[model samples]
Target: MEMPKEFESFAEARKNNFLNVKAAKDAGKKVVGTYCTYTPWEIIDAAGAMPISVCSVSDETVEDAEKHLPKNLCPLIKASYGFAITDKCPFIYFADMIVGETTCDGKKKMYELLGEIKNVHVMQLPHRQNDPVALSLWKGEMIKLKEKLEKDFGVVITEEAIKKSIKVKNEQRNLLKEIYSLSKLDPPPISGYEMHKIFDATNFVVDVEAKNNELREMISGLQEVAATGNSPVSKDSKRILITGCPSGGVAEKVVKTVEEVGGVVVCFENCSGIKEKCVNVDETKDVYDALAEKYLSIPCSVMSPNTGRMELLDELIEEYKVDGVIDITLQACHTYAVESFSVKKVCNENKVGFMNLETNYSSSDVGQVRTRLEAFIEML
Candidate 1:
C-alpha cells in the first residue's frame, strides 16, 4: 500500500526516533524512559529531560527475557525486560533514568529486576482513584518525582516551565482528538493501522513543537481527502472498536487481520490508543494538582473501580457507529483478562458483537488469530 503524503513526515520521524534520542543525549540532555501513559510527559519536559516510552512488542526478545521471567507472564513485560537486558533497544540504553509505575503486578515485579540493571524510580500509583486520600497520595508522588528529577538532573523545574509544557502537550492532545474524530466519518480518510502508527510514532519524538506541526499538516491532508470522498476503507466495511491491554507490535497484526477479513477498526480504547489522548491537563489550576488529576483520570485496569473505562468505551462505540468490539488481551495479563468479562457484559447489553482475543507476542499464533478474526468479521 502506498503511504499517505501527510503521514510521510511522521513515518520519517518514527524511523529516526532512536537517532534523535541519541543526538539529544550527545548534546547533554537527560532522557527518561517510561512504560505507561500515566507517567506525565509534561513533568519530564519541565525538568529539562526528554521522556520516551520504552514498551516493546517484538517477539524476538521474548526468549531472552524468558530466561528470567516466568513463561506465562504478559508478553509486554517480557519484551520490555528482554530489550533492557539484551541492550537491543536504543531508547532504553540512552535513558539516564527510568520512571516505573505500579500499573500492574507484572510490571511492578519486573521493575524490581530492571532496577538492578538500571537506575529506576518507581511511582506508587493509587488503586482507588475516587477517594480523596488516593488523590492526595498521587499528588504527593508527582511532587516526589519532581524533586527526584531536579536532584538527579541538577535542573530547577519552575512553575512557568510546567505551564509551558502543559500548553504544548494539550495542543498535541487536541490534534490527536481531532484525528480520532475522523474515524467517526462514514468512510474514514485513513485506515486504523495508519492512525495507530501516527499516534505510536509520537512516543519517541522528543521535540513536541515539531510533532505538533506534523500533526497539523496531517490533519490538513486528511481534510482534503475527506472533502474528495476518498477513503482507505470501503463504506460498507464493518466498523470495529478494540479495547483491552496495550498491543504494541501486535497492533499491526490485529489491525491487518481485521482489515484483511473485511472489517475496519474505527476506534481503539487501549493504552496506546484514543483513551490516552482524550484528556488534557488543566493549565488554569495548580500544575502539580492538575497533572495528578489528569494522569489519575486514565481508566487503567489497576484502579479498584474501573467503570469509567466501560463508560468511555460505550461512548466511543456509539460515536463511531461500531458494529463489533474486540477486546485484545496479551496472555497472562491478569488484570485485563479478568476485565474482559465486564467488557463482554457491556457489549451484550448494548447488543454489539463482542470477541475476546487472548494471545502473546509470538507469531506462532498468527494463523489462529487470523482465522478467529475472519470468523468474527463474517458474523458482523
Candidate 2:
C-alpha cells in the first residue's frame, strides 16, 4: 500500500533511531535509555538528556540472553537483556544510563542483571495505583529521579524547563491522539499497521516540533483520503480491538494477520498503542506530581485492581464500535497472561467476541497465528 508523503519522514525515523542517537552523542548530548513509557521523558528532557526507549522486541537477541536469563522468561525481557549484553542494540550502547521500572516481575529481576553491563536506575513502581501511600511513594520516587538526573547530568531541572518539556510532550500526544481518532471513521482512512508505525516512529525521533508537524500533515492527508472515500480497509472489514501485554514486535504481526483475514484493528489498548498517547499532563499542577499522576494512571497489568484498564477497554470498544477483542500475551509474560482471563470476561460482558493468543517473539508460528486469526475473524 502507498503511504502518504507526509508520513515518509516518520517511517524513515523509525529505521534510523540508532543513527539519530549516534549523531546526538557525537554532538555531546547525554542519552538516557528507558524501558517503559512510565519513565518521565519530561524530566529527561529538562535535564538536557535525550530519553530513548530501549525495549527490544527482536528474536535475534534472545539466544544470547538465554545464556544468562532463564530460557522460559518473557521474551521481551530476555531480548532486552540480550541486546545489552551482546551490544547488539545501538540505543543501548549510546545510553549513558538506563531507567528501569518495576512494571513486571520478569523485568524487575532482569534489570538487576542489566545493571552489571549498564548504569541501571530502577524505579519502584507501585503495584496498587489507587492507594494513597502508593501515590506518595511514587511521588517521592519521581522527585528522587529528578534529583538524580540533575546530579548525574550536572544540569538543574528547573520548573520552567519541566513545564516547557511538558507542553512539547503534550503537543505530541495531542497530535497522536488526533491521528488515532481518525480510526473511528467508517472504513478507517488508515490501517492499524500504519497507525502503529506512526506511534513507533514518534518514539524514536527526538524533535517534538518536527514530529508534531509531520503528524499534522499526515492527519491532513488522511482526512483528504477519507473525504474522497478512499480507505485502506474494506467497509465490511471486522473491527478488532487488541489489548494485553505490550506486544511490540508482535503487534505488526497480529495486525497484518487480522487484516489479511478480513478484519481491521480499530483500537489497541496496550502500552504500544493509542492508550499511551491518550493522556496529557496537567500543566497547572506541580510538574512532578502531574507526571506521577499521569504515569500511575497507565493500565499496565502489574498494577493490582486494574479497573482503569478495563474502563479504558470498555470505552474504546464503544467508541470504536469494535466487533471483537484479541488479547495478546507474550509467552512467559505471566502478568498479561493472567490478566487475559479478566480481559476475556470483560469482552464477554460486553457481548463482544474475544480470543486469547499466547505466543513468543519468534516468527516460527506465523502460519499458526495466521490460521487462528483467520478462524477468529470468521467467527466475528
Candidate 3:
C-alpha cells in the first residue's frame, strides 16, 4: 500500500521536534512549556512566546523521577519531573517559562517541587464546569496568567494579539478535526498509530502556517488514496474508540497492540484526540471570556460531574460507528480510573463493547496487556 509523502513528513517533523524548539530558542524566541490540554495556548501565544507541550510519555526517565517523587505516582508526573531534573528533554530544557494547571493533585504537587528547579506558574482551576462563579474564577486565573507572562517576558499581551491567536489556533483545530474525521470512512485510509503520530507532532511544529499547509495537503492526499479504494485497514476490522488519560505515553503498548490484533481505533476522546479539537472558541465574544469558556468546556476527568465526556463519547461512538470502546487509565490516575465506570455505562447503553485497562509506563506488562487485548479483540 502506497502512503502519502505528508505522512513521512509528519513523522520526520516529530523526530526533529527537539531540534526545532532548540532552534527557536537560539533565535531568542520565548518558549512556554505546558503539561495539560487545560492550558490556554492563545494567552501564551499572545504573550509573544511559543507554547509547547512538556508532558513525557516514556518510562526511560521514570526510575530517576521516582527518587524524589513517590514510586506510586502517575508515571507522567514522575517522568515529566525526571526529565526536568535530569535535563533530558530539550523542550523542558529550553522553556523560558512553564505554565501548569490544578487539573490533578499529582501534577499540582509536582509543580511545587518543579518550581524549585524551573520558573513555574500554576493556574487555579475550578472543576465545577457549570457554575458562573467558577467561570469567573477561571477567567481571573487566565488574566493572572496574562499578567504573569507580560511581567516575566517584558511584553504586554493586547486584545488584538489574543484575538489573532484565537483565530490561528482555531484554524489548526479545524484542520485536525478534518484529519481525524477521515477515520469515519469504512476501512480508514490510515492506521490509528499513524493518525496519532500526526496529532502528537502538532504540538512541536514551530511554524503554524507551514504546519497547517502541510496538514491540508495531507488531507487531500489521504482523500485521493481513499477514493482509489486503497485503505491501510480492512473494513472488517473492529472500529475502536479510545477514551481515557493522555494516551501518548502508553500508545506504544496499547495502540500498537490493538492494530496488531484486529481493531482500528477510529476516534480518540482523550487530550491527544478530539477531546480538545471538537470545539472552537467563539471569536465573537470577549477574548478572555471566550477563551475561558472554550477551554473550561474540555471534557477531561479533572472536571467534577464530567458529563461532557460521556456526551462526547456517546456522540463519537455513533458518528464513528465504533464497535467498541477502550478506556486506558494510567496507574495512580484515580480520576480517569474511577471515571471508567461511567465510560463503561455509556458504552453499555450504546450497545458497544467496553474494556478498562490500567497500567503504567513500563514495558514489564507488555505480554499481560497483549494477552488481554487479544481476548478482547477476539470477543469483539
RMSD to the hidden true structure, all candidates: 4.7, 4.8, 5.0
Which parts of model 1 have CA positions greater than 4 angstroms off?
1-15
Which residue pairs does candidate 2 place in steric collision?
none
Task: State the lDDT at 225 in candidate 2.
Answer: 91
Model 3, range 289-313, lDDT digits (tens) per residue?
9989998999899899899999999
Error of 3 at 354 (Å): 0.7
lDDT over C-alpha atoms for residue 301 of model 3: 94
TM-score of 3: 0.96
Instruction: List, residue by residue over 1-380, the lDDT tens digit for candidate 2.
Output: 22223223333545467667778888889999998888989989988889888858878789999998899898889999987887767778778999989888888898988888888889999989888898889989898888888888888889999999999999999988888998999999999877777787776776777878998999899999999998888999999998887767796578877988899988888988877777899999998889989988888888898888988988899999999999999988887888888888889889999999998899899989999999999999
**Cα displacement (Å) at residue 265, model 1:** 0.8
Which parts of model 3 have CA positions greater than 4 angstroms off? 1-15
The TM-score that candidate 1 achieves is 0.96
lDDT of 1 at 143: 93
Please say which candidate is ahead in TM-score: 2 or 3: 3
